[model samples]
Target: MAKIVDYGAFADRLKAAPNRWDVLREFHEEWGYAVRPGSDRWDRWTEDEHETYVRALSGEPRDEDGLEGVDLALPIPAALDEWWELPFNSFTHDSQHYETNPVYPPTVRPDPSGYGVAGPLQDDSDLVAPDADRRVCVFMAENQYCNEWGYLAAEAHDPDPRVLVSVDDDRWALQARSVSEFFLQLTVQRLPRTLGWSAEIYDGEEIIDGDEDDLRARITERMPELGFEPWAELQQDTIVYGGPDVLAFVADGELGGIAFAGRTPRAVLDLAERLGVKLTEEDLTEPGEY
Candidate 1:
């Protein structure tokens, strides 16, 4: 089930407005849509708009979350709000080993107190709201979490909403089919360990070092079977193989990480293991705070 918003109607109203900015301002002030700063595109907005939207959707932060002078216009589920309070390094299960990536952490504005949850929305020229207006990215994982990519999106315009996870910009995987389902998984089931900082499970040590050519050959041979093709240069140390479904990260003649659109975590892990990468207990455990 998709949660649809009347984006067409909203667009229509914006088109009818004598002053486009005024319409956007009204949308922000009244209908809770964040007006993008420095851009006339109604779909685009500042990071503050994202924070505002999250705050408005989730209400005030919890007392223990260290948020003050904040009011809840609409009450969001306590569990979702708790997610916002979690420290940037809180993704790892072990509190003692909660490490933050130096590059990504400084960029993230802590929710409830700083910039709410996510960074600015990425460019979406296709639709005002992607996924048929059913979802909006609320948070992005730190770079250390699967190479500083991926997003935590929430269902919009629905009473019973769910959280979605997308490693790449294109496709999404269901994180929680409903809000209650999300809470249950976070608190009890703990199946989707990749949520928040739990993705550290996949951050294993560099096990095998092959020649760069060998690594490229292996990827050229194996990735297509996995539904990906060589895409572009990632960094001086890395090569990227991209497809509609997954992104393969290769570095130093080793497969560093794989971001999947439709693949299961277990399947990806199995593939990694087959490639000679193994997850040690330490890798699966929380890391020390950086």
Candidate 2:
């Protein structure tokens, strides 16, 4: 179950710690969260690492109207400062690839090069932008860990407002609201369920070679009637389909496990029903509701 984190108590501890690193270590140890080796010590930034980050920020190509260098105020939430080094997937329930070992926040660079998802601010990027003016912060965590390619964002500049938003292949959807709330939902409400859909089957399930062919035929036959066209290529274990209202996923040949794009979760659920798969309420929920 997701423990209700006392943000007040956490902040107080961070302020009282003689060595912030030591406090972070203790937090991770107690929580069963994994931290990247070097990242655990944020005070030890190499000259090159600092320079690279500075260069990335200074060299950020921007339009005349675009904001320069992340415009948010510094000294972000204390919990985020202490916990950023920990792997997001470590907190996930049934993460396949990122369960035991996961990527660290330092692996991401905060350069505003592409449209958040493609280049400088991808899911793996270390930097998280908190532009309240724009009402979004992209690259908050890995898409795989959250079952949707998304970031911690807010729809409006209201008090205590945030949401999990997924944006893939130009399609986007609000997955959940607030980081703490999302964690509670995932760990408490949806315990034992896999984080997101993927191409590989889990729990000793066997894949039938011809199942992929059948699934593809079904999609090709029904997608048009549902008001979408197959757009991208059918990569190794994933299929990218849909145009304006896009739906993409990494599916096993038999559709045993899958991950769909953010904006089309309901549509994907409908499609799954048509494909003879019945998803539960836990399988997909509306934004802001578990």
Candidate 3:
């Protein structure tokens, strides 16, 4: 049987959360973890094993796999500090060869930390903010498929600063008003499509065979209370919706996929029930998480 999370209980917990970190922790505990292939990582490494591996990868002495101590060239946001500490988050600088990250940029690594992390956006950053030169960038996370996401140095001390996304390292804009909102937006939008067990309503699996435009239109008609917001300004028609307990999204125009997720198996399945979409618990054969 698919595990179902109690919507009422989860909603209550979210409202009662003391702060944003608590909300993130709530998802961490519920979302669980997925160990990508070849990522046994910290537990498998002896004290010096990871150190030696980093040194070998960089061709110089280094101590950390990710951005533990590397100078981001600006003050680190408190929310980012907390994000790095989350034990359950799968996003991190584990094996540079295995995972996606900020170091993907070609020009930024002249000062190679060797862990495949990018240095501060120096020199060419005049393209983004010519007047605010001191307000550079400190990229926290990125992936090969998605544009890079980070924060401005000007808002570094603000605990939860606004998020910035770039088409390239230099073409930047506000992705979210605050870090907490950004994480919520990212989680709600991403879970439905990427989670291994999720059903693709329009494209990919073609499980629903619904027209992309119609699927989006009907969803909007049914859940008028839940409004869609831009997932990224550059990714047209890719929008996201979040509720106290449920989250849903529509992807880029070509795929036009619709996905829904909640705290547990039952929670997401209820989306089918509410939307009158046809799906069964048993249909969730693949495991959850990335």
Candidate 4:
């Protein structure tokens, strides 16, 4: 979500400006948005009222007025190909720290205990080695951890920095604080603009002469029209034809096929007899069974 700025800070920035209009201008300069106060009988204004008008000020390119007409007040973040990195964090006195001290040292000194033989040697020394088994959850965790503990390690490590690549994620996180922000932004930007951009071309349409349903009806409604007996087999989105002394016609939208039935052993001979029509090749291949 876009970080919420303090309204008091916003108001303070505009305090020097003369009137509400100046405040609106300064507000836009601070955060790319406008706010308008609500109205009851349609005569009211508030600090946030400017948003109502300025929000409609579009940034879309216009040829007649050129850049002057472009609405720079629109809150849409400029599209960035790369992700913006939020600061890891700030330093504080009460910040959590993980540390360790030796309870007892070796009886015989290997390196620094410096004793021949003893019951147990107590040494006050801190272990500053970083843990190697911490699994990173988010992309930012890697950089944040590196910023904190890059120096201490058993094996030398070079943490490769990463960034969020998706534009959709960046866009929504700017508009609102929800998963539905993308949908809302798209709706607000697209739905109202569809007045000039709509799919009116396909409003009224006609089907081709060999419409799947029509073709099938021609075979079954009058089998003698094609010199055969009537039959129909309906599958999911598919219509098949079969009967005595008939060429089975399978029709599915643009895809149609005719195969030989009862009297014909080969489909080629049947098609040869009933020539002058489109035929689709039969697909005998089965899926995944192979």
TM-score top scorer = 3
In candidate 1, how many Å is residue 90 off? 11
Query: Candidate 1 lDDT (Cα, whole model)?
Result: 0.33
Against the true structure, what is each candidate's TM-score?
A: 0.29, 0.31, 0.60, 0.15
lDDT string, candidate 4, 66-116, tens digits: 123122322222111011110111001101211111111001111122211
Q: Report residue 151 deviation for candidate 3 (angstroms).
A: 1.3
Q: Runs in model 4 with CA error above 4 Å? A: 1-214, 224-239, 244-290
- When 1 and 2 are scored with lDDT, the better candidate is 2
Per model, how many backbone clashes are there? 8, 5, 1, 10
lDDT of 4 at 148: 11
Q: Which structure is stronger by TM-score: 3 or 4? A: 3
TM-score, cand. 2 vs. native: 0.31
Better of 2 and 3 by lDDT: 3
Better of 3 and 4 by lDDT: 3
How much lDDT does each candidate structure score? 0.33, 0.35, 0.51, 0.23
Clashes of 2: 5
**Could you give candidate 2's per-residue lDDT for residues 147-258 as a string of tens digits?**
2322333222332234333334433344434333333223321221232221221212543222644665665564432111111111112333332222334343343333
Better of 1 and 3 by lDDT: 3
